[model samples]
Target: MAGHYVIAGKKIPNHILSMGFIGAYAGAYALYALKPKPAQPATPPIQASSSDEEAFIKEFLAKAEAEESK
Candidate 1:
């Protein structure tokens, strides 16, 4: 009997079946080897000094409190 390609209860050509398998294998290898890197989280900008940070926080809190009172 001559060899036949039977897949999913259907008949196909041997070359088509072999090419399909080769393509699938190549796709899997590409995915495994060429996966994209995860994106890095954004870093906060550097502040000049602790005094400047404290002053900004104090002003922000004062403004927030004024808004709440209104």
Candidate 2:
């Protein structure tokens, strides 16, 4: 025989608990799936040129090194 649940003090079948968990999961999934998504920009963002990025990185490292020497 299935033992009584400690909290409820009743013999709850395993199948019932499994069904409850499945129902809860399905309900949560339905809520998430139906939620509206944020709008996206029409135009993509502009990126910096490779040369400009390299220059910025060099400048940053130079400043960091200068500060470390102080």
Candidate 3:
């Protein structure tokens, strides 16, 4: 006698159960392969500053010295 599946006390044929399993796997794989990817974020453009770097450093140091003296 060949082996069979007993689901919910009902006898299911092996070939039918195998086909159902294969069909489910195929359908899941199809859905996974056809799914759309998320969109990539756009990066902002860099701008060149027109301000003087030396003046900025000097101003920062002056503020730090003033705060330390208090």
Residue pairs with colliding backbones in model 1 are none
Worst 10 residues of 1 by lDDT: 40-49
lDDT of 3: 0.81
RMSD of each: 8.6, 12.0, 12.4
Better of 2 and 3 by lDDT: 3
Score residue 21 of candidate 2 by CA lDDT. Answer: 89
Candidate 3 lDDT, tens digit per residue, 7-68?
99999889889999999999999999999989876644333364576567667777998999
Q: What is the lDDT of candidate 1?
A: 0.81
Off by over 4 Å in 3: 40-70
Task: Give the lowest summed-lDDT range of ten residues in model 2.
Answer: 1-10
* lDDT of residue 29 for candidate 2: 100
| Cα lDDT of model 1 by residue, 1-70, tens digit | 4457777998887777788999999999999999998988665544547988878977887799899999
TM-scores, in order shown?
A: 0.42, 0.48, 0.51
Cα lDDT of all candidates, in order? 0.81, 0.79, 0.81
Q: What's the ranking of the predictions by lDDT, best on top?
A: 1, 3, 2
Error of 3 at 57 (Å): 30
On TM-score, the leading prediction is 3
